[model samples]
Target: MSGTALLLVLAAAVCHASWNVVAHGVSRIGTPFLWWGAVASAVLWLPVVPFTGGLGGSVGGLALGAGVSAVLHVVYMVVLQRGYAAGSLSTVYATARGTGPAVSAVLAVLLLGERLSALAAIGIAVVVAGVVATGLVDRRPRQAPAPVDGAAAIADGAAAPASTGGASEEPAPRADAAPRRRRRLDPGIAWGLLTGLAIASYTIWDAHALRTWELSPVSFMVGVTAVEVLFYTATLGRRRRELLDVVRAHWPRVLAFGVLSPMSYILVLVAIQTTPVALVAPARETSVVMVAVFGALVLREGSVAKRLTASVVVLGGIALLAL
Candidate 1:
């Protein structure tokens, strides 16, 4: 990455991380929050379309690319929201962000004919390894109690002070619940992986769209976001009341994210215009570390020290990719 591109990507990382934190805060609202944000993005960017010179090439081609990107973005939003609802902010965010660049790198190599340096390959592996390790550690089960021996249990009970009659007895733990708890799916991790795939699809698609159509980034974002809002509204028609509730409660945040999401991606798109997507993809994902930090400091979802360690490893990988 060149100096200017690196700076742009880093700035975009901060914006991306900040908005994701905002999104995770309202993850329970899920698609409602995203739909509103998309609406806000559309409204915010529409006025600037003309100023940005609008679509400068084939209108049909631009619309086609925008449509495809809009669909992929919708998938990304749904999956990311599911991830936030199901897991800790750090783990889910890390996994989703990590998966994007990794998949994007593969697609770029195979379909886009992009090449990577030896250091970049190693960096990508390190990033993938760190993400996998963090996910594994996040999913690790806590130690369950050891079985108590009858003699020991009886002795311990005999030595304990008698409870007062005024005190209410606590309910016994249910043995039957353990199986159900164990069987429950970690939707966050599952959705995080899916979100990565969606991101990779759009990343490659957007790159091709930009290269082929030469559309202004501003106009392209405006068109795609408008379509995404329409798509969300059509699909979520049944949950209009819930969507309204979210909008009434968090309109400010919705607006902020609406602006941040596109601005962040626009920066990445600009970087991609000048640099290889292989390099830009991983560099842009430096946001993984940024979001992990926010997840710890702002959300307090997990161990900050542990998440920071994992993030450092991810940054190391990004640095190598940059080299």
Candidate 2:
């Protein structure tokens, strides 16, 4: 990766983390996601609709790509919601984010006929291994005992004398005494895999389309966003009220999220146009580490040690990719 491409990928990583934090921090995930999509579509489409004269010629392919993307987005929303609801924020976010680029790299080779240098392939393997390790560690069981120290005294606020009770007679160790619950993998992880495939498909396809049609970046985003709005409204009409409520309550954050997301995608797309797809995809996965950090410090979730380690591993993988 060139210096400029690397910088752009880094910027995209920041944007990806920011939007995810906004999505998860909201009171309702589904509604915020919908609103984010709508606002993003409007932001991209409204300003440049008039200047898209050249885009008119490429409308068919752009629309087709957008249609595929919209479907993928629906799947993404579903998986993202379930992933956040059922698993640790760091674990699910790391898996989903890391998996997409990995899939993209593989698909780029097979479908797009892109070649990765031997070094780049090694880098991709290291990154994938790191992501897998993070997931494994995040899923391990934890032990958390109930608050027993507070109840060891009498009503007189004095310490109770110790009793030589047998080990089995020690209140039977509380029948409910069990290790802290390990979150179950969301069935959405499967959905997340599908979502990642969708993302990779459209990204590679769109990049090819852009090259063939020579569409300007602004116009391409506008067209894709317009089509996405139509598709989302058509398919998710049942959830309109929920979607609207989220938009009304968190309009500013939603708008910001929307704007940043497409901008991030645009940056990655541009980077791929110039750099190797293998390089760009792995570099983009750097967002996984960012999300893990956000989960620890910003979201204030538990498992700090695991998350920190995962973040380091992810960064290490990114470094390897740069080589």
Candidate 3:
């Protein structure tokens, strides 16, 4: 990679993590939050669309690629929002981001018939291992409830029936039941996997689109951002109130994510013009580590040390892939 491309990728990494932090902070709004962000992004980049080909320059095959990319991005946004809802930002983000490159690598080998060096293979393994460790294994330290003495248990049992017919004791078991049910379905891992798949799909489509159209990065991004905004807006489906609520409550985030999301990728697109996509993709994922740290420190997600360790391993693998 050229020095300028290297710097652009690094900047993109930081900006990517920063907006994700913004989104994670208000993930409760779900798809609405995402939609607003896309709206903002579309507005901001709209001017560039006219200058950079107005969503259809030298049209023939570019339309399909751009359309597919827009559809993929909508799915990516939904999965990311849901992932934030179901899991900690660090684990979900790390797992989702980490899964992308590994899957992308496999696709390259199987579909594109790309060859990797031994070092890149090892790197892919490390990335997969780290993702499993971070995403699947519940490493959060559980606080064991203090053990009750036999005498106290008997005393409590004896006293319970006289008061409200053991109502308090009944609710304890019922309350405990919900958490057990929740534990059975770990949405974090599931959503992470889905997010990874979406990333891989878009990566492949974008690669093909670039090769076919050879359009400038600015034009392509502007068109895609506009389409993403339209897609998300159309899918509101009885959720318009919820979307309005997000806009009212978190306009700053709407603006921040709006600018950051598209601009960050614009940087990557520029880098791709100068460097190979193989180099740019892995280099951009360095944000995975940054997102983990942001989750632990700014968001106060648990198991910071363990998550960071896993993030380091994943980043090592990504760096190897880039090399």
lDDT against the true structure, each candidate: 0.68, 0.59, 0.63
The RMSD of every model to the true structure, in order and in angstroms, is: 12.0, 11.9, 11.7
Better TM-score candidate (1, 3): 1
Give the better candidate number (1 or 3) by lDDT. Answer: 1
User: Can you give the TM-score per candidate against the true fold?
Assistant: 0.77, 0.73, 0.72
Report lDDT (Cα) of residue 275, candidate 2: 77
Model 3 clash pairs are none
In candidate 2, list every pair of residues with a backbone clash: none
Residues 182-242 of candidate 1: C-alpha lDDT, one tens digit per residue: 7877665676688778878889999888888887787788788788768767766567788
**Model 3 lDDT tens row, 1-323:** 46687789889888887776666546544456656766787688777766765545456556666677887876675666556555544455556766776777677567655677788688667767775565433344222222221111000001000001111333345676877866775566677778788887787667667665776566677667667667666766677777766788899878987788787887877776545554566667766566656657676755688778877887787667656
Q: What does candidate 3 score on TM?
A: 0.72
lDDT of 2 by residue, 1-323 (tens): 67888898989878776666555544334333554565575675567656644454477766665556555555555545444444433344446655767888888888778888787787787776666565555453322212222112111001111122223323434445533222444443554465456556666766666666665555666656665566556655566667667667777776765676676776776677677676787777666566656666766754778778876776776777666
Find the 10 residues in a row with the least total lDDT in model 2. 151-160
| Residue runs of model 3 more than 4 Å from their true location after superposition | 1-4, 49-57, 77-95, 110-113, 131-191, 242-245, 273-278
**Comparing 1 and 2 by TM-score, which wins?**
1
User: How does residue 255 of candidate 2 score in lDDT?
Assistant: 72
Model 3 lDDT at residue 30: 45
What are the runs in model 2 whose C-alpha is more than 4 Å off? 27-33, 48-57, 78-94, 140-192, 236-239, 242-244
Candidates sorted on TM-score, descending: 1, 2, 3
